[model samples]
Target: MSKPKAVVIYSGGMDSFTLLNRVINENYDVYALTFNYGQKHVKEVEVASTVCQTLGVAHKILDISPINQLMQSSSLVGNIEVPEGHYEDDNMKSTVVPNRNMILLSLAIGYAVDIEASKVYYGAHAGDHAIYPDCRPEFVNAMNDVAKIANYEPISIETPYLNSSKGEILKDGLTMNLSYEHTWTCYNGRAKACGKCGACVERLEAFSENQVTDPIEYE
Candidate 1:
């Protein structure tokens, strides 16, 4: 019997990389979809490519750089400096690319349909919900509903880490022996990760909680 197919929205971040491995481990014929939306962390696209090549998964990168022009309020794409702090800090809200997940999910779901995949998987975790409305559980539920209605064949959005924290995600990834070093989570897109950014801080804390040293370099 053939395994069911899934299209994963991969970002080359720790969470999404873990999701990719989990999907493959669960026996899904994995397809990775990455979006290049002109975010400050554009280096993640290169990282995504490396991961997909290493994992031998079919990967596609869609250029949606125009969205950056429209959502200039986000520090991810605008001239604003990327905030540095814990994920819970209010300043981190500036990193929220408006409706980012929704836009990505819409494209991913359509790609899933085109490829006849049964599901679209994204790595939105509880840690992000405080700052990103689109990462909330309610948003996932609603997006699943939209996918069901939008697809001719039965298709849905799957967010396994919707309620899981960054720490838990790291633990799971460690169990799978994922190559964390290749993943990029810095918002500044620097040569080395800006260890002070919200993304870097959360990732560091997660690895610490798991009692594992992160393989990535930091400055």
Candidate 2:
């Protein structure tokens, strides 16, 4: 008997990495999808690749770097500097890739329709509400409406951590005994995590809130 099918937007970051595992644990035959949209670094892609391989789940990295041209206003796409601060700070708006979630979810829904997967999973939590408008519940609700009507074959969009904080998401992942070492959250994508960056700081804080070692090195 085949388990149900689902697609996970696995970005190799702590949140998505956790989402990937959560879906698998739910007994879905998971297809892990990663996008190389020309971010500041490929380290997260590299990390996602390794973890997906280790888990023996089907995975693919799509190169949509050409679209980076349209998204250059954000610091994450081109030569702009990645600012360092609290994840909720207004300065971190530089890290926002305009229409990122919409674009990614559109593709993921298409993929799900192709694969006959009934649902698509992603990690968008409460913590992102302040910095990323698309991560908020209203966006998810709106996107969920579209996902069901986007095609003849309806698809469900699942956000398990929608109301949770980063720390809370990490807590669920920890309960699964997942390792954080396989994840990469640094926007800098340097040799070591620039612990000062917004992503890194949030990751570090999550681990702190859980009262556990982050298990990754930082600069």
Candidate 3:
């Protein structure tokens, strides 16, 4: 019998990349699904492709640029200036695209059903719940139910970060021998990570908390 196919919503960030290895290590056939949802950081998508390629997993980068126009109010889209400082600040909420995760996961679930994949994975950590409502455990559970009913199948949405912190995820990934240096976590659309951006600050903190220095270059 073939192994169960799992589609991961990978963004080449710490959490998603960790989730990718977690699923792969579990012996599931992994497929990485990346979305270009008009975020200021296009580097994440490029990094996602690299990560998937390195893992020898099937990968696809879906164009969801239209959603960017619809979500123009978000700081992540359009010409809005990327916010600097910590991820826990109220200013970071400005970057949240309304129902962005729902939209992405919905699309991934649809694709999973089309491909007969058994599980869909998303990286939603506890720290993100303060800024993103859709990243909450309740939201993920609700979406799982909705997707299962919408597809009329037993498909499931997995949130490995539901009970984990960003620091824990970095530690887990490091323990698994996962490569963190190539993963991009900047909110700015730049060649090198702007160390002041909210995402960059968060990533730095995670590595710091884990007592490990992040290998990625930052400016």
What TM-score quantifies how close candidate 2 is to the native fold?
Answer: 0.98
Model 1 alpha-carbon drift over 4 Å, by segment: none
Per-residue CA lDDT of model 3 for 78-187, tens digit only, reads: 67787887878988888888788988988898889888998999999987878889999889989888877886777899997797889988888989987788788888
Candidate 1 — worst ten consecutive residues by lDDT sum? 146-155
Per-model C-alpha lDDT, please?
0.92, 0.93, 0.87
Q: Mind giving the per-residue lDDT tens digits that candidate 1 earns over 1-219?
A: 988899999998999999999999999999999999999899999999999998899999999998799999999999999988998999999999988999999999889889889899999999998989999988999888888988677688999999999999988988897768899999989899989999999989998898889888888
The alpha-carbon deviation from the true structure for residue 157 of candidate 1, after best TM-score superposition, in angstroms, is: 0.4
Ranking by lDDT: 2, 1, 3
lDDT of 3 at 80: 74
Q: Which candidate number has the best TM-score?
A: 2
Colliding residue pairs in candidate 2: none
Clashes per candidate, residues 3 or more apart or on different chains: 0, 0, 0
Candidate 2 achieves a global lDDT of: 0.93
- Candidate with maximal lDDT: 2
Off by over 4 Å in 2: none
- Pairs of residues clashing in candidate 1: none
Better of 2 and 3 by TM-score: 2
